[model samples]
Target: MMKKADVGDKTKTFHKGQAIYKEGQSSGEAYIITQGAVGLYRLAGNKRVTLALLRPGQIFGEMGVITGEKRTSEALALDYTEVIVLDQTLLHTLLLKSPRPVQIITSYLVERVRALNALVPERSSSNTFASVCSVILLAWRAAARSGPKSEAAQISTVELSRTIKDILLITQTEIDEVLEKLARVHIVDIVDVKGTYYRTDPLLGTKKKSGEFVKERLLSIPDAERFARVSRNMAQDNPDANGAELEFIDLDDFARAVDAQPETILKKIAYGEVPPALFHFHKRQALAFAASKGQDYFQRAKRPRLKVEDLQNVDDVVGVDNATLEEALSRLGFYKVGVLAALAGDEARQKIYANLSKKIASVVREEVQRMPEPDPGEASDIEDELIGLIKSIKGISG
Candidate 1:
């Protein structure tokens, strides 16, 4: 019969309903409940699924200790309980004293479980900061495997993309979006490495010259875990289950909105730095982007194709009788005013000269910068669309 053992290093008492450990936390030692009960649970969507309840003489947390894995379940003190803590050293010693065949079989089983875990589909989070944290940890593990170079770890986007997708529900495009933001925030550097890898064709596989994206970081990791926690808790900020909340920009207000220019944003998207999924673009460019990706990137941002609303914000409207100003904003019926905002780069600021009050123009310019741009070949198509919109606005308003 199983019996409670006092061989463990120390003992402690936990009040009822106290958390002994949470899921996804680092594990080192195992616990034995000498008194009271403990419960193991996990979060499945919004529901908590209880896995087990343990009482005296039962040992728990051995799996995490055996595999050096994160705690897969939350252990709560089901009642006021006395527990014994068995540290890593004692666990290692105990394992060493096990029978030879038992040791061999246990090691093999542990290895098998780890290998199978990769085949399981799981989503840790879709939060940008959390994704960033996960990437850093994954990169460190990969770098350690290859023997890290210098004080930092380096990893190609390709391998990092593959590993992240295997474990999380995120996609390649999503990963790229997170990496670009991380680079902008100075947490990581995106370097273009010129190289040749075998390219397979219908007939033959040959070496091809191309640029590989690699994310490199300094040896330091600061507040990554803490930031991830904050982001995860704030994941509810994303409303309605869309990948990201879509923000709209009215092109008729483009000129008034600090001459709204999307060139920089477009270049980033066309070059694949920003995911096309974030933007709303019409014309053949939008169709082509959807066709190339086998998905509707523009569908995320829903906006009216044509607006002919009567201007009704009598209290908010600042009197402006000038034809250009009227055409830029009054006719469009969207006068979200605030004008000191700027886009990401210097090039973006030049296209925007505010006619819509200093404060409103700045804010509009920032939104325009937030909008997407297109490739050189696709640029003419979108530019033509913009020209047509400008022409229609002028002709109709008159």
Candidate 2:
């Protein structure tokens, strides 16, 4: 029998979907699941392929510990979970002292290796294609938060097709045909960046709209009405029914949105990692589904919140005198989300004045742009404000 090695007070807790370590990360530690479940996954193109679900008492990251190699797969919490971290050096010393654990670890490694090999190419081509699509959708959703310049916005049709081809072992022509069909249905937008011919070569860059673009495209599709009806029905059947209007999309549609296989999503729902609202076999609400799962899962743990009463002095929090803090607050506005205006350079001061002036001008322009004749009084007022703003910028910069 193998004896459990004590790794010391190195236990850690993680929330659902929080990554223990990402693929390609350095691995000096293996983990013993003390409670909850962990998912082992690999990035296949943009989609996460689930390798295994590790239950409590199972050990993972052992391959890295033994081989001293970089992690090949990512480990994520399936739920609120705790694990005992075993560092490689400590584990090696323990194994040297104890023979039983080595035998047990060897057997475990062999089993896991076999399981992984079997899982790699077990699914049919169609399923593989669907999985690829789901990954693309997830990437888009992630990229959406960062605005237009994000990677999702820049993904080309060629890149997407190649990903599908690689996963499903299909020809470029077949992948293109599939994309064309998806585009016809408005599930995907095949964009030609600057009138360039869109070809299915991985190197040729193109643009595709994801996130809000996909959401809007769905509304325009003929299938959306059917999805809406299914959503309504599912809402009615839900045990946790609420009166508030909710958006719903079918599993197939949701799969299309996220570029994932419907079955993969079903598995996640079963694991309780995904909310039940997303599992209405007929319809899954895309936005709500995303919010419920994405917000809690994707969001990094926030900084420890501080209450005013918890601090002996308010200055303790900011590490500044009251006078300095007050001055900064007044200059930067109440939110203090960005840099303080008082501390900003000449360029920033100029931008602040320009922004204020432009805002004033914009309101004045909107009110008068529609007028057959410009309002002289409003135009004069706008000019005065602009001139004053310029003067303020010059004075401040000096």
Candidate 3:
């Protein structure tokens, strides 16, 4: 067990010779022995190998629970046993409530544990690629926030790793591999610098430096989006590889998935963008049934979304604060939905997403997905109306 922490009210009992949980079962909790003893074992062929016998006050299954991986070993009651179960939710709450220092240390420790338990089978490559994408994008975003945004952003590897590990259990090696891959493709440059003020110390009881530490690796990303796109192509090429996970918001794929040419998807996206497979299947079904009514039947149609610049007078709303827009939406009550609906397409959605909360964006997105395919003329009219409404707001510039 990582910490002999307080146990929640959840507990389970098993009689002597009873199996508590089998190896390869879905992992859900870290159990603290309360009474009697429990034996941890692994199976090799027909043989059952004893790993450890945990007594009262001891804990097991923390590895699987922390990594969110399946159980690697079976647990059996050596005698009548009772164990306190620290389920995932409770564990998360405990970690989340901890002080910043504790949280940071816990993150590092968790990463190490995950690395140690590498023998345990892991998740799909698509998931790893997603993580890689998130780390890179987040690192780039962090650099942008710290200073003026630039075409090439320099990010501290240590800071980036720490920040990402605090939220995700991805190991440093995984992240390094992603960056290295990006560097290989000329998407980023991993440089080593000396005498820089950035701290590169590992959190191991060392005194904090006052904005002065040696710089090990500084990541320079010329374009985060291109880096992300290349990552997508890498993941698509080898999705099951263990190295990286990428966040995918691919424009071209989305276009193809919706059964439209890239150019057609450029117009005005209708539904909330969905999973590639599911969206493709639904589009196929719709085209199959709806083709008879259309004059040109054989050509499959693609759902569309308009680029922000393509929207009528989109420049008028480009930098407007979301709160101001929300207030405007309230004023134009009838056009409020259409106002949000106009925020479609990769570039347009990026603008909205950058300035708004995900909850509000999701609400807007869900509504758009449910609406019928938008009329281009109506969409332009909605955009025009929305822009006019926004320009009327006081203290707004551009």
lDDT of each: 0.53, 0.52, 0.63
TM-score of each: 0.30, 0.39, 0.32
Instruction: Give residue 223's error in model 3 in angstroms.
Output: 2.1
Scored against the true structure, residue 219 in model 3 reaches a CA lDDT of 80
The TM-score between candidate 2 and the true structure equals 0.39
Can you write out model 3's per-residue Cα lDDT over 1-398, one digit (the tens) per residue? 43445556677899999988888999898888989999886643212445578899897887677678888788999999998888888777777887999888877987785564453333323256555565567557556655775555687888778755543456889777777777788977778876534344576756554564455778877776687678778866645433322323345445656777764454333333443443322244357567756856546754333333333544334445667666655655333453455545555556654554566667666666676767778777666776666665644344
C-alpha displacement of 82 in model 2, angstroms?
2.4
Per-residue lDDT of candidate 1, residues 42-64 (tens digit): 65332244557899978788778
Window of ten residues with lowest summed lDDT in model 2: 213-222
Query: Model 2, range 210-261, lDDT digits (tens) per residue?
Result: 3232211111122334433443343344332111111233455677679898
Residue 210 lDDT in model 1?
A: 50
For model 3, what is the alpha-carbon lDDT of residue 154?
Answer: 80
Best model per lDDT: 3
Better of 1 and 3 by lDDT: 3
